[model samples]
Target chain A: MVLSERDNHLIAEIQDGLPLSSRPYREIGRRLGLSELQVIERISALQDGGVIKRMGIVVRHHELGYTANAMVVWDVPDDQVDSVGEKLGSQPCVTLCYQRPRKLPEWPYNLFCMIHGRERERVLEHIDSIVASQGLEQLPRKILFSGKRFKQRGAKYR
Target chain B: MDDTDRAIINRLQESFPITDRPYLQAARELGIEEDELIRRLQSMLESKLLSRFGPMYHAERLGGGLSLCAMRVPQHEFERVNEQVNVFPEVAHNYARDHEFNMWFVLATETPERIGSVIREIEQLTGCRVYNMPKEEEFFVGLKLEV
Candidate 1:
C-alpha cells in the first residue's frame, strides 16, 4: 500500500511502540504537527487495512511470576497438523503456536507452542496436560527454555 | 491515503500517557468526544487488524531470560518437530526461516539457568542437537508496517 508523507512520519514515530504517557497521541501529534484526533484516525485506518496488527502490552512474564518458560516442539502428523494446531492455539497457556519448516539432519519439528508458569515443575505439568489433552503421549517432543533475554520489542513499523 | 485512515494511524503512533482516565485525556487532546475515541479503539481491536492496545514492557528490566534458538529437523519430520518445539511456554515466537537451521524461535524465562536446562531437555528428548544461537550483539530493527 502506498503511504503518504504524513503516514510515513506517523508510522516512524510509533514504530518503537506507543509512548508510555497519558497523552501519548497528543505528544505524537505535537511532534508530527497533527492533532490527536488526526493521529487516532490514521492508526484506526492502518489497523483496519491490516498494516498494523494490534497494539498491546508485552508483559514481562518473569515479573508476573511466570518464571518457568519453555519452547515445546511436537512431531505432529502431517494430516493431523491443522486440527492439532488449531486445538493447541485455543489454549490460553499456549501463547504462540505456528508451523515451521524443519532442516534435515538438523531440525525435526513442525508444530510448536509456548508454555509458561512460575515454577519449572508447574510448567512441565502444564506441558504434560497439553500432551495428554492433545493425545500426544506417543509423540516425540522437546522443550527449550530461555537462558538470557538479550532483546525484546514490539514489531517496529518503520 | 484517505483522511480518516491517516487520522487514525497518526493517533495510534503517539505514546499514551499513564494516568487516570488516559482515554479521556487523549480525547481532550484530540478535541473529540471521549466515547468516540474509545469506540474507535474498540472497533480497531475487534477487527483483528490490531493485535492489542496496551503497554510494551522492557522485559530485561524485570530480570527475564531470553534467547533465540534454532533446531535442524529433517524435512520429513518437520511436522513432528514443529509441534514438539511449540509446546513450551517459553517459546514466544517461532518462525520457519530459510536456512540450514530452518526452524528458529525465541524463548524467555524467568531465570537464566532454566534456559540452559530447557535446551538440554529438548536435545535429549528430540535426539537432535539444540544449537543455542544466543544473541551476542543486539540489532534494533524498528520496522513498523504502515498499512
Candidate 2:
C-alpha cells in the first residue's frame, strides 16, 4: 500500500509501542496534529491494507512462569503440510508456527512450531503428543530449546 | 478474526497501565468498566488468538544469554532432529526461514555458556552441525500483525 508521509510517521511512532497512558492515541494525535479519531482511522486503514499485522502484547514467557520454551520443526510431506500445519498451529500451547524453505544438504525441516511451558518435561510431553497425533511417526523432527535470551521484540514496520 | 476481535487486539498491543490497579486503569482508558475489561481479557486468553497480554521485559538489562541458532538436517531426519532439539527448556520461537541454514530457533538462557552446551547436545542428537549465530548488533524489527 502507498504510505503517505503522515501515515509513515504514524506507523513509526506506534512501531515503538504505544505510550502507557489513559489517552494514548490522543497523545499520539496531539504530537501529529491529528485527532484521536483520525489516528485510529489511519491505523485501521493500514491494518486493513495488510501493512500492519496484529497489534498485541509481546510478553516475556520466562518471566511469566513459562520457563521452558522450544522450537519444534517437522518434515511433513509437501501435500499434507497445509493440513498438518493448521492443526499444529491451532494448538493452545503452540505459540508460533510457519512454513519455511528447507536448504538441501543443510536444512530439511519444512514445517516449524514453537511450544512453551513452565517446565522442560511438560514442553516435551506436549511436543510428543503433537508428533504422535499428526501420525508423523515416520517424519523426522527436532526441538531446539533456548540456552540464552538475547533479544526479543515485536516487528517495527516504519 | 472479526472487527471486534481486531479492535481488542489493537488495544492490547498498546501497553497496559503500570499503576497499582492496571486493569482498572485500562478499563477507564478503554471507556469500559473494570469488570468488563477483566471479562474480555479472560476470554481473549482462553482463545489462542491472543498469545499473551503482559510485560515485555528487557532481557539484556537483566543479564540473560540469548542467541539465534540454526541446524542443517537432511530431509529424511527433520522430524527426529526437531523432537530432540525441542526437548530443551530454553528454546523459544523457532522459524523455518528460507535460507541455507534452515531451521532457525532462538535460545534464551541464563548464561552464555549454557547456550553453547545446549547447541552441543542438539548437535550430538541430530548428528548435524549447530550454527550458533549470536547477534553482534541488535536490529529492532517491529513486526505487528493487523489482525
Candidate 3:
C-alpha cells in the first residue's frame, strides 16, 4: 500500500515503539504536527487495513527463558508443500513458518518452521509429536538450533 | 519475572489498547494500578525482557521487502564478514546457526527492489556467495509463544 507523506512520518515516529506515557499518541502527534485524535485515527485505520500486523509488547524469547529455538527445515515434495506447510504452521509451537527456495546440492530443504521453547528437550518432543500426528515421519528434515544472536530489532523504514 | 510480570507479558503480547490513557485501561483489566503497570513495563525494558513494545508494521504492504539470506563463511573469516554485512541498516537481524550455511540474517529494505541490490552489495563486500531465500509463501499462524 502506498502511504501518504504524513503517514510515512507517523510510521517513522513509532518505528522504535510507542512512548511510555499516559497520552502516548498525543506525544507522537506533537512531534508530527498532528492532533492526538488524528494520530490515533491514522493508526487505527492502518491496523484495520491490516497494514499493522500487530501492536503490542514484543517479547525477547531468550530473555524470557525460551532459549532454545530451532529452524526446522523440511524437504517436502513440490506438490505436497502447501499441505505440509499449512499443517506445520497451524501448530502453536511453530512461531514462524515460510516456504523458501532451496539452494541446490548445498541446501535441499524448502519448507522452514521456527519452534521455540524454554528447553531443548521439550522443543524436540513437540517436534516429534507433530511429526507423528501429521504422519510426516518419512520426510527428510534438519533442525538448526539458533546461536549467537548478533542483532535483533523491529524493521526500520526510515 | 514474577507472576505479575508474566501476566502482563502474556496479556500485552495479545493486544495493547490505543487510547488517551492506555496504561490505565490496561492496568484496570490486568487488576493492577496504572503506575505499577507502567513501572513493570519500564523495568522489563531496562532488563531486556521486552525487546520492544509497539506496532509491527507489514513492510510488504507498505512497499518494503524482507528476505532471509545466508552465507557459508569460513570459521576464520566469520567475524570479518559479520561486521561487513551488518554495516548496512537493511540487515535487521543476524544470527549464527549450526549448519553448512552457518550465517543467517534477515534483510528488511524500504523498497522491494532494494532487497536484490543489498544482497549484491553484501556479496561484493564479504566475498561470499549469499543464498538469497525470499519467502515464496507464508502460512498463516496466529498462535505465538505463550511465555
Which candidate achieves the best TM-score against the true structure?
3
Q: Give the least accurate 10-residue stretch of model 2 chain B, judged by summed lDDT.
A: B137-146
Task: State the lDDT of candidate 1 residue by residue for A31-94, as single tens digits.
Answer: 9999888887887666655455345433445544555767777777778777777777777677
Tell me the alpha-carbon RMSD of every candidate.
14.5, 12.1, 1.4
Model 1 residue A37 lDDT? Answer: 82
How many clashes (backbone atoms < 3 Å, residues ≥3 apart in a chain or on different chains) does model 1 have? 83
Residue-level lDDT tens digits of model 3 in A112-142:
9999998889999999999999999999999
Better model by lDDT: candidate 2 vs candidate 3: 3
TM-score, each model? Answer: 0.54, 0.57, 0.96
**Candidate ordering by lDDT (highest first):** 3, 2, 1
DockQ of all candidate complexes:
0.07, 0.09, 0.77
Question: What DockQ was computed for model 2?
Answer: 0.09
Model 2, runs deviating above 4 Å: B1-147
The global Cα lDDT (0 to 1) of model 1 is: 0.62
| Tens digits of per-residue lDDT for model 2, A27-141 | 7789999988888778667666656544446544655456676777777788877777777766767766766656555557777676778888998998888778867678788
Off by over 4 Å in 1: A20-22, A153-157, B1-22, B25-147
**Which candidate should be chosen as best, given lDDT against the real structure?**
3
The residue-by-residue lDDT of candidate 1 on B34-99, one tens digit each, is: 677766665554553454465333334334566667777788887777777777777766766445
